[model samples]
Target: MTAWLSVIGIGEDGLDGLSSAARTLLGQAELIIGGERHLAMVPDDGRERLCWPRPLKAAIPEILARRGRRVAVLATGDPMCYGVGARLSRVVSADEMTIIPALSAFSLAAARMAWSLPDIETVTLHGRPAEMIIPCLYPGARILALTADGGTPGTVARILCEQGYPDSRMSVVEQMGGPAERRIDGIARDWPDGRAAELNTLAVECIAAPGTVAHPRLPGLPDDVFLHDGQLTKREVRAATLALLAPLPAQRLWDVGAGAGSIAIEWLRSHPNNKAVAIERAPERCALIARNAAALGAPLLEVVEGSAPQALAGLGAPDAVFIGGGIGAEGLVDTCWRALPPGGRLVANVVTVEGEKTVFECHQRLGGSLTRIAVCRGEAVGPYTGWKPLMPVTQWAAVKP
Candidate 1:
């Protein structure tokens, strides 16, 4: 006999988001887990309310040990999206849990803006760094971003301003799907002066000059857009790497040695609602990545401007990862591989002989796909009489088993 855990998604409007069945489940549960706001939303009956203190990971196992007890965990929006349900599921089997999903804030914000969600890219910054969204931004792309807090809107505006999109139109939707909902509209160059809602989302419309970079498919962006200092993958090579990684909707990507952030940016561009975190040590490079993402329309790109493998700490697990620059670092490949789930994918790109050997060794140990790529272009060498070979790229792609 086992206890059942009910994970419920509530909205800013409180109990109104719950379905009749969900409400019944909450009423019957003896032990309830939630934040103060969610706890206050439930009808104050005799049901024992447990406040979730900091360090939720430590508390899960202890609470689950109490077998045969009914439990209900509360969360905002869909618990599965950037919420607590996934974390709980890591420890508890799916058979022991029931999830009741409500309208996600991203969806609500899109509706309020009178925009079709399928057509707009959406990213979440809640409980994540702003740098995570950098690679997704593209020129003329519309985006719906779930901000971490009130300060997020200003941060987004500042980032967009730093990029070339100073005139980009932005709409901030606050307290979405609730009675107190409000919407504010402005340009990135001149964000309106007002306190933003703690619970809010942003809508950005990218303005790009014609005949620059071609628009890519929803999830896979062309590699020509990013500004890199010879550390980035060419457009053709980047597309190949992303194809092997196979990013899905809502999955998070951990991009190491982000370099101009080609792989990370493409992951977000592949799916409107996808997420990623790009890690880079160079401050100037990090700033460049941020500008590239915002200009492209991924205002949610989170840039972790610190050196790895030290900077890799504190980041939660990712669905997939791409290692572009740090393959030769000691234990870097092993650390990333260990962090992945059984089905998680890791793709690394290399050019130098040392990098190739490192990736090959990792492939033999980890078991995945290996390939070499050679690209050449015909430069105008005295009226286009000769072909110049671009540097070859060695790619090793693998899935954790």
Candidate 2:
């Protein structure tokens, strides 16, 4: 058994809360690895101790070298639940490791609140910005968020006020499973963020204030919700593009020429596992992409600043790719077509005549449907309402064979 590694979950109470099996395994550990906080739990164990190195993902090789030795990793709550165990598991062989789980903080928090775990949503603001919680702010929703530090509650509180959830009730539950464990309750508008301790988890009982129109978490989010500089993919067309892209579980997308990052944002909003990378040439647009993604709850969207083809290099092949601009650029479409694997979807939209010609020529050779989307909205013309035609968009979409 010493030849395989054992990753153990220890709580705030440290060794006192561990099971007999976990205690025995930890006792025999020839080498232990954990953060400074978790390391303080065990005293004079008479074993070699190694602090978890910085950039933990990059430290995998050093960890794997200790394999076949009596090695133990101390983790918080459940190691598989957004802990280092999951990170290392991606690089280390599963055959050489065993994971022992403890009760998760979410489980404990839900239990304390008497809220059913399945009925409530759980997210971790751990090492994440509070703006990333926007997608979960709809009325009547309950959320258990793991906070990074004492300041996280304040940040969350401010975000709620801006997002029209000022009346949402909050619970700052501190140091769960420890002697210091306690819950401080208040509304988002009056949250005593500074009063809460560092090691805390926040539970939200969402109740949108009166007349605070909520941004419904759906494919067709209204255009006004995003802070764009007039250059936007119209709401109706954006919805159609997302439907054509067909976001699926665990799929990744490349949003090339991501003017306002609407497509990528919607793709991420579709599912938690869904991922996207926004590539834009203009620095201003890239900035918008980051802010829009964070504000809309997909902060994980990677924004790379550079034109396509050059920027697309070294990027992981995407499950789907959307070209929202620069359709007339030479070799841009060809590179995207070749980069996609079989069954991968590629969709591009254009408005200019030159851009349409490019897409039409590609359709003739590649054989995808060419569609001209023309939308007309009601407008006041002197006396009565009249139909106002907007710029027509030509869209071409195909799957790699």
TM-score for all models, in order of appearance: 0.67, 0.93
- Per-residue CA lDDT of model 1 for 1-401, tens digit only, reads 34388899999888876899898888889888899878988777776778887877777875677546888999889999778888888888888888998988777877777888888777777776565444445687788888888988888777666555667788988888779888899988899756598888888887643444445554445555668787787877877888888988898899999988767777876665778899999988898888777656555668998877788888878888898887888888888888889889999989899998998898888888889899887778886567789889999999888
Give candidate 2 misplaced runs (Cα > 4 Å): 1-3, 193-195, 381-383
lDDT of 1 at 66: 55
Model 2 lDDT per residue over 1-401, tens place: 32368889988889999998888888888888898989999897578998887777666777788778788899999999889889878876787787888888898899888899999888888987676688788899899898889888888888888888999888888999999898888888987636568888889888887887767556888888777887688898999998888888889999999999999998998777688999999999889989899888888999999988889998988989999998887788899889888888999999999988999999999987888899999999999999999899999999889
Could you tell me the TM-score of candidate 1? 0.67
Alpha-carbon lDDT, every model: 0.80, 0.86
